[model samples]
Target: MTGAADLLSRLVEEVNPSSAWRDSFIRIPRHRFIPDRIWVEDGDDLAVLDRVDDPDAWLRSCYADRPVVTQVDDGDTTGRGYRSSSASMPSIVAMMLDATDLAAGQRVLEIGTGTGWNAALLADRVGAGNVTSVEIDPAVAAQAEEALGGFGVHVVLGDGEKGYPPGAPYDRVLATAAVQHVPYPWVEQTRTGGRIVTPWGTSFHNGTLLRLRVGEDGTASGRFGGNAGFMWVRGQRTPHGTLDGRVRPDHEYAETSTDLHPYEPVGDFEATFAIGLRVPGMKDLVVFDGDVPGNPHYTVYLMDPGSGSWASWRIRPGPRDYRVRQHGPRRLFDELAGAYTWWQEAGRPAHSRFGVTVTCRGQRVWLDDPGNPVSPEDPV
Candidate 1:
C-alpha cells in the first residue's frame, strides 16, 4: 500500500502546481475530508456508496482533484432524485486557490466548509489559527469542525450569507457556494483592500470565479476568472412555490427575439460567451438531449428565478423571429439577451474585465465593469 501520503503527492503532481501550492496540496490529505459513505450518481438521482464497496474508486476520487458529491440534500431525500449538494470538483478548487493567492499567516474565510479539505489546505498554509470556515448545515459544520479540530481552524454553523462577522476584516474570503449576488456580509467581513473570490453567476453550471477587492466604502469590484459550478447557498434558493403550469411538453409555443443583437448564427448554444451573458447567474444551466444539431427538433432552456421566468428556445432554421412563451416577473431570455448586448457593446471582454458587488441586501451577482448601481429597477 502506497498510503494516503503517497496518494496526496501523486495528486499534487497530476494536478500541476507551483512549488508553494504543490507543497500545500500534499500537506492536506483529501481522504480525511470525506466520509465513510458519500453521495454518487445513481441514474438520475444521487445515491450513497459505502466506501467499503469500492475503496479503490473512493481513493481515486478523493485524490483525483475532483470535488466528490458528499451528502445529497443532507442524506434525507432519496439519493435517486435531484442533487442538492456536493464536495465540488478538484480543478474548480484549484482555480479558487489560484485566485485566492493565500499566503502564510493570512486570515481567510471560507464560505462552504464542504468536507473541510479546502479548509485544511488553507490551514496548512495560513496556519489553522488564521483560517475560519462556515457551513450552513449544522451537521456538516459539526463534522468539519471535528475533522479539523486538531488544526484549530474555526468552522462555524450558520447561514453562509451572514458570514462570520466576528472574524471581522479578513484578508481573503473564499466562497465555494454559487451566489446569485455578492452578499453585503462578505464585503463587511472583509478588510478594506482585501480580496474576495467566489463562484459568481446566476445559474448553477454557468458561473465564473469572481475575484474582487473590497473598497473603503464596503463595495467590492473585480473581474471574472475561469468558469466553475457550485451548489446554490440555502438562503439563495428562490421560493419556487405555487407554480401555475409545468414545462409545456410540446414546447411549440416558445419563441426567440433579437431586437438588440445583430443576428449571427448560433453554435454550441451551451458554450457561447454570448449565451452565458444572456443566461447569467441562472441557478441551473444544462444541455438536454431531445434534438441534435441538423435535426428536425432542437431546443435548450434558459431559466431565471428572480423574475420567475423561463425561456425555451430551439433552432428550426425557419425564421429569425419566433414567438416566445413568457412566464413569471421577468421573461428570462429577454434578460439574457439584454445582458448579452450590454456585454457586446462593451467590446465583448472576458469575465476578468467584469467586476462584482455585494450589495447591502446580500445579493452576490456578477455585473459588467463600470458597474450598475442598485437602482429601483435593477438592484445589485
Candidate 2:
C-alpha cells in the first residue's frame, strides 16, 4: 500500500468521484482516526493489529475500503466479543455523504462517533465548528476526541438516542450506527425541511439506508436508499435472551404443516425488507440439520421476544410442506405467512420503493407514498 491518501483517492474514484465529498476524503487521513491497538478479523477470529508493532499493516488496514473494528462489545470485552464501533467502509461513507446532500455551512449532528473519522469528514464538508457528534461509550469518545483534537469538532459522551439537545434544530442528523426505529428526539432536534439520514432496519435485517426529510410539524419522511450494514445504536441493541430462556416448558403447543416457506422472502433484498416491515420484532433463526448423519433438512425458528411466542419449522427435503409447531398467544408462522402474502400482493417493493415517516404518532414505514403505510405498524 502506498499510503492512506492514495488508498482514499482510489476509494473515492471507485464509489462516487463526482461527490462533493471528494475534497473531504482527501483532506482527512483515515489512519489518524484509527487507534493504536485495534482488532482485525483473522478468518473467523480476531487478532489485534498494533500500529507500533507493524506500521505498514496497520496503515494498510486503516486506509482500506473495508470497515476497521475499533471497539468491540461496547468496549467492554477486549479482543472480539461483538464489534461495537468501527470506521465504516470508505465507499459506504462516501455514499452516505452523497445521500445527505450536505451544504458548506449546514449544522450536522453525528450519532455513534466511533473513531471520529466520519465526523472529521463531515467537519471537512461543513466547517468543524458546525459539526457535533454523540458517542455512548466514554472510552470510545475519549479516543475519538484524541483523534479529532486538532479539528474543532464537539464530541458529546451520552446516549445517542436522546441526541445532543444543546445543539437542537440541526440542519442535518446522521447516525453512523443502525437504529431499529428513528428516535423522536432526532426528528425534533432537526430543523424543518432538514434531513436525517441513517441505517434503519430491524434485528433480522440492517441493510436499508433511510433518508428522511423533516416536515414543519416535527415529522420526518423520506425514501430508503442504498444498502448498508452498521452496528446497532447502543441503546437499541437487542437482548441476547434465548428461546429456551424466554419460553416455559409447560407452555401450550400446536402443530401443522405448510408448503409455504417464510424464508423464501428473506433470500431476496426487497422481499426481506418487506418482510421485516410487515413482521416487525420477529427474530428469524435458521438452523441447518447438517450436524446429523444423512439429514438434508433445516429448521426455522420464528421468535417474538415481546409476547414470548415461538414457532419451529422442521423443513424436510422433499416437495411436501414443512411441519410447524407453535406455542404462545400469537401464531408466529401465521404472522410470517400473512406478511409474505401482503408483500407479494404489494408487488414485493424494493428498499427504494419503501419510505419511512417518524412523528409523535410513531415511526411508520410506507410504500410508494407516505399516505400509504406499511400493513402492520412498525413494532416497538
Please name the candidate that would achieve the greatest TM-score relative to the true structure.
2
Candidate 1 deviant stretches above 4 angstroms: 1-6, 42-45, 78-80, 238-245, 248-296, 304-309, 316-324, 327-331, 334-342, 358-380
Question: Tens digits of per-residue lDDT for model 1 on 272-357?
Answer: 44444445445333344452434544454555655546665653455565444555555666765665556557566555554555
Candidate 2 lDDT by residue in tens digits, 1-380: 48776876776676664458777877888888899988888875677788999998988888778899887777665433688789999888888888889998999999989999999998988886999999989999999999998787999999998889999879999999999888889999999999999998886677778999999987889999889989898777766676568656887789898888654655567777787777767777766686563456877788888788888888786787889889888898888788778888877777899898888767888889988987645543
How many clashes show up per model? 25, 0
Q: What's model 1's overall lDDT? A: 0.67
**What RMSD does each model have against the real structure?**
4.4, 2.9
> Each prediction's TM-score against the native?
0.80, 0.90
* Model 1 residue 222 distance off true place after TM-score fit, in angstroms: 1.6
